[model samples]
Target chain A: MATLSINSVRKSFGAVEVLNNIDIEVEDGGFLVLLGPSGCGKSTLLAIIAGLENSSGGDILIGDKNVNDVHPKDRNIAMVFQSYALYPTMPVRRNIGFGLEMRKVAPKDREAAVQRAAELLQIEHLLDRKPGQLSGGQRQRVAMGRAIVRNPDLFLFDEPLSNLDAKLRVEMRTEIKRLHDRLGTTTVYVTHDQVEALTLGTKVAVMKGGVIQQLADPETIYDRPANMFVAGFIGSPTMNFLKGTLEQGDGGLVLRHAAGTLALAGLQQDVAGFVGREVTAGIRPEMLDSGDGPASLTGVVDVVEPTGPDTMVIASVGGQLITARLGPKDRPRPGEPLTLTVDTTAINLFDPVSGNRI
Target chain B: MAATRSRSKLLWDVISYVVLVGLAFIAIAPIVWTFLTSLKFEEDIVTRTMQYIPSRITFENYVKLWNQSGYPVLVINSLIVTTTTVLLCLLTGTVAAYAFSRFQFKGRTQLMLGYLVVRMFPAVLMIIPLFIIMRQVGLLDSTIGLAIAYTSFLLPLFVWMLKGFFDAAPKELESAARIDGTTRLGAMFMVVIPIARNGLLATCVFVAIAAWNEFLFALMLTTSQGSRTWPVGLQLMVGEFQLPWGMLAAGGMISILPVIVLFAIVQRAMVAGLTAGAVKG
Candidate 1:
């Protein structure tokens, strides 16, 4: 419904800065996820967006209107908290309709809106029950119902799925996505879970130390992260960082390290200045496969873990642990020499000193 | 080894029940004794033999206490003072506790500690100063004055207890309410207060009991039967040489009736309220 732009926003507690001059923009109807680990200020950023907490500096504009001094209620935003935060005493109907009641909406219209929300959430049967009586998944639906019924310009979710179990978290994650697609409201969601960020966000702002490390679509953030931190943070089983020297070889640039040389091919980013300099080559686990090609890197298998369809082969290459996602049939025994063909085009190169993607 | 462990477990359970029964009896025996004494005839009460139970159960003492003295007026006075004190403490203390629970203002810690310091003083130490102030303000002998005096001493305790309950109420709920279009004050009334109402009730009952049984200030401040609370009235009934054991026991029973009824009403809610914050929502 609205575009949210946070411009140069900064927050500090005493002398220690919590959010350093942060800037992000979410287009109308775009889902922007602030993703990071705990103490990384993702929730703080969401709070600032919701107007629950004031930024020490900068302007937050929700649909061209600056809301730096606007009260949370006046800002016309609805938030679904991690704990759901459904009014414990109110039945589900009243919980969803409380905003309308606070706005002094007519009873009939309020009931209709609440009914619509409950129906959409498939929680019409729970309307008369209190939050305490609801199961974890039911409470999550009620929390979402409370948000969507308001139909605010922006929907803010602060790790709303964190309280649910693993299966419920995925289910509610899909539920949230379906609601977003149906409502098409500009939403800002905050979570430390990388999977949620990648799955739910149209624009994922991966943050660290209160700074936005990378702001891009999920694929780009996954395939070409801005730096080592984001490259390391956004994937499961994590990306492997091979410490090596970048040297200009016969064909193009190749990395020389303890094990062998890995030819870097089709690198979209310029790295001519880093020739003969040490650069950390980042590789995704799934990009490595069993091969005896010229670009193959061999290492001693340290650990083998088979996870249903895939076996994770953690090997020691140049005395550094590197995990390769191989097929279930390619289970290499520990202490065996395992050679893996690196997907050279997909590899990321980062400056070892600065940790910046080159 | 297994047999010895089972035997030890049985011994432990037996010892625990013994201690628990002993404690319960120590607590309940006095109330049981008082009720029995209230039911006894004056002859039985005054006899040289220590009669545990009455030879003849009679309601004479209750009738005499109710009709022969100013006990009814004192009961009404105590009710008014306790109710007023509770209302006053709740009115001021809820807001104070909420402020203490939510806000991080300058001197918050010091102000809370100051409330505790006021409670640390002996109640008797405050009587003279309170008496002088009450007399200066022309409120020395009225129920309202006594209620105000009770509030001064009990307000800190009320705030301390209510703060724990308020702290247990999730701050995120208030944030959600505020985002849902309620002001901070409105959110507190709509969300926080409703969540904490049971605790509030428990706190009200506690303050009411304390105000009801308070004697030192009432004894020193009130001069007329119109203003004296039941405890002061009961104490005054103990004439220099005449103890009136039966009437005294009857008065004790009368004074505790409201407290017992209140406890019975709020017992389940109080237990639930105490345990409400043990788990996350």
Candidate 2:
């Protein structure tokens, strides 16, 4: 219901800084995910936005009002914690209605709001049971119900699905996306799971070492990462980084490495100045096909793994290992010479020195 | 080898049972003897013969002690003092413990250490100063005066026990409450306190037991029977030369009655509270 703006927010615990001049903005009804591995300060950033933590410098605005000095209650935000953090002693009905009670809503109105939230979460039968009596997934619903019953201006989730098992995590992830779509409240969710970020976020901010490495749409983040770290962090089986020298060749540019030279096409960004310089070639695992093409790399297969739908083939290109996602039927034995066609248009080239896209 | 192991295990169990039964007898023998002595006639007690059981049981000792000794008033005084001490300790200790568990102030560690240091010293060392202060404050022989004195020592114990329980409570619950629309204090009352109430009850019972049986402070602080606790009254019953063995035994039995009743009432809750923070749910 409200746009959140965090401008140059910094947080330090004593002398050790956890968040470094963070600036992020979410439009009204937008889902922004702060995604990174642990210790990346993504959770700290979310806590700062919720007014649960203070920023050493800068301002936070909810809607149009600066909320840097506001108490968490006055900020009108609801948070779903990773632990579910339900009141263990209260039944689900009172747990969901506690916020309205604190806000001094009338008894009848609070009951109705709690009932509506329970229905939305499909936990009406659980209204009289305490959190300890609920299963992991049911506890998660109660936590969500506690948040949605307030109808607050912002919804903050701190890795709310991380505690569930894998299948439950996926199901809750879809349930959360469905709720967001139905409610359309501006939400800031923190998670280290890239797939969750890709699926749930309208805008994903990939963070590292307390810095925002890349902030873009999920597709852009996956396709055109800003740096080598972003490229390497966003994909499973990871992006292949070929350390080689970039040279001007007959057709366009070619990379010469320990392996045979590979032709590079679709040079979208200018790299003419680095003709004789060392640059790293980035390629997604799924972008490599088994066959010869205009731009291809040949190597000896090192390992083959079939994961039902797709096969992963690891091969030593010179001395560096590269993983390619091939068709399930394309299984080459170890030590077999294999050539893979590179989706040249999707390939990325980065400066080896700075790891920046070129 | 298997036969030898089984034989040794059976022997070990026999030895363990023997040791446990001996310890139980040592603990229970004095109470049993006291109960039997309280039922004996004065002649049976004064005789030179070793009489473990009275030939004829009599209620004379109990009736005389309850009617002539002013024992009921002392019991009432002990109740007032113990109740006041428990309330005072809970009122101050719970807040202090919560603050210690939640906040990181400049001197929190030092202040907590200071509370421990107060308990480290001998209780007798505080008696003179406490007596003088009580006199100056006009609370010298009152039940509230003794209660205040008890709180001074028992509050540290209450705070330390309650702090563990408060620390076991999840901080995330408070954060969730705050975001759900409660102030920090409101969150504490609504979420933290209720979660920790079991531990609070256990701690109250602990302090109450300590105050109830405390004899030294009760004896030193009180001047008259009006303010004296039952333990002091029981000790005072032994006249310089005349020790009324039957009456003293009956009074000992009577003094422990409330403590036994309290334990029976809160036994289950106390055990659950004591083991509360030992595991994660």
Candidate 3:
């Protein structure tokens, strides 16, 4: 296992730049995930690191040596493609052993490696079957097995679980996590699925428009996103953004929205410069409580979705709608006036124009 | 409702079969007739009336043609030329096609367009210049010379056909192989080529058929028995005074035998390869 460092990497196709002055360093044996929507240069960055594509300018250091001109084969990296790009003509045994064979490993050793990979993946019975004969899950395992047998310096996975069914994807995700735990190879994975990034990555780099918005641990990225894009992109159901201005009101500063005013107790100290200036009030859906409390906001319920464990309530106040996640027992029906308590400490403030955290 | 729907479906099936069979007979009848005529006596063959089946079948024409004419030498020459041409076409074409499919070099589009333009030009238009060139190189009337000329003509077709096949192969398969420790070239041979076997077989059959049926180049380039191919030799059988119908028919049947046998062996692969990249299913 080796650490990979990408320094000021930039890639361009003709005049259109795909990756712009990106820099990232992954620690040894760390799981680094590049998370972004499609066309955001996440896959291109991964490809550049794998030596499958050349960056127009930068130094890619694997362990310590620069690998800018190194061929993909010489880079000693294995990539599991999203398509599970198995050799359709070869049986599972050969597919898994192909790397060993190419490296000039002896026949007996190659067979042993193949057997070990198959056993680890619990696909021993599938060794003689071709890729076409395997199911989707089996193909995914075989693709993983092909990468595993090589024992490369880094494992690059380009959304390897995206093609599987929902249940199978979850199972495979767990399997990959288990594999990574056991092997502890430094891996760089790319995916658009935020959940996958959160679950699998020790360090997640959220990107937008060919730029890294935030690079931090999963918990830190989720709890303290660097900007508006990172906050919105990293969470499911997404954080609600209420456009408002911060003002020093009675006792403390409060965010005065078009719909209503939300009192800010701890936030005013950090956001004093933005007083009387428009900012976005960022609140996660789960941070709102249904019970009456000291910090409560009154609004009329516009929609309520009871999802068994929790209730999702969309409330409207003065023509502005805000979504809040509450307990299933306190789900208010539509048109019902409700007072939900906002967890003021968990609320995030961002500059409305620049989208930077305030 | 179910019974009425089934009845209409059955009617449609019957109509489809009738049309297919009609087309099939139209395609195969001439071939069958040609084979039967090759077995008939010279007198029976030239009679103004048509004979569906002869009272007696004879192998005399086949034996007489083999003994009298240089049919044996011509047959051997055709095989050597066509086999050599097909092999060369496949060797050069597959590599060129793989390069076209995988690489993103400068002028790739222009080079592909140039290949297409070469194929678009009529083969007849090239024969005169080709004839002169071959004669200047002292390659006229030689099987090797004819094979080389045929490669020039057939390579573009093979390259174009095989490029489609290679393009149908997912690039990920080769990239995966490269990551598995194989060089780019090694990955192509070990992964892409194996998956594209059907296409390679199809291209071989196409090149072979074209070389085997080539008339103008073979006639113009070859003069003596040492290098004369079957097509040229067969055309010579129709003399100035009277056409040797039985002998010509016998020679024609002999020339077509190899193509039929080859097609029979690789019909499935040929169909699959020829239609590559046209439709997904």
Native-to-model Cα distance after best TM-score fit, residue A354 in candidate 2, in Å: 2.1
Between prediction 2 and prediction 3, the one with superior lDDT is 2
Residues A128-230 of candidate 3 have per-residue lDDT tens digits of: 9999999999999999999999898999999998999999999999999999999999999999999999999999999888889989999988887889998
The CAPRI classification for model 3 reads as high
TM-score of each: 0.96, 0.98, 0.96
Q: Model 2 shows how many backbone clashes?
A: 0
Model 3 clash pairs?
A: none
Docking class of 2: high
- Give candidate 2 regions above 4 Å deviation: none
How badly does each model clash, as a count of residue pairs? 0, 0, 0
Off by over 4 Å in 1: B1-20, B278-281
DockQ (Cα-based) per candidate?
Answer: 0.85, 0.88, 0.86
Q: Put down candidate 1 lDDT per residue, A32-142, tens digits, no spaces.
A: 999998999999989999998989999999999999999999998889999898898899899999999999999999999999999999999999999989999999999
TM-score of chain A of each: 0.98, 0.98, 0.97
> Which scores higher on lDDT, 1 or 2?
2
- Among the numbered candidates, top DockQ falls to 2
Candidate 3 or 2, higher TM-score: 2
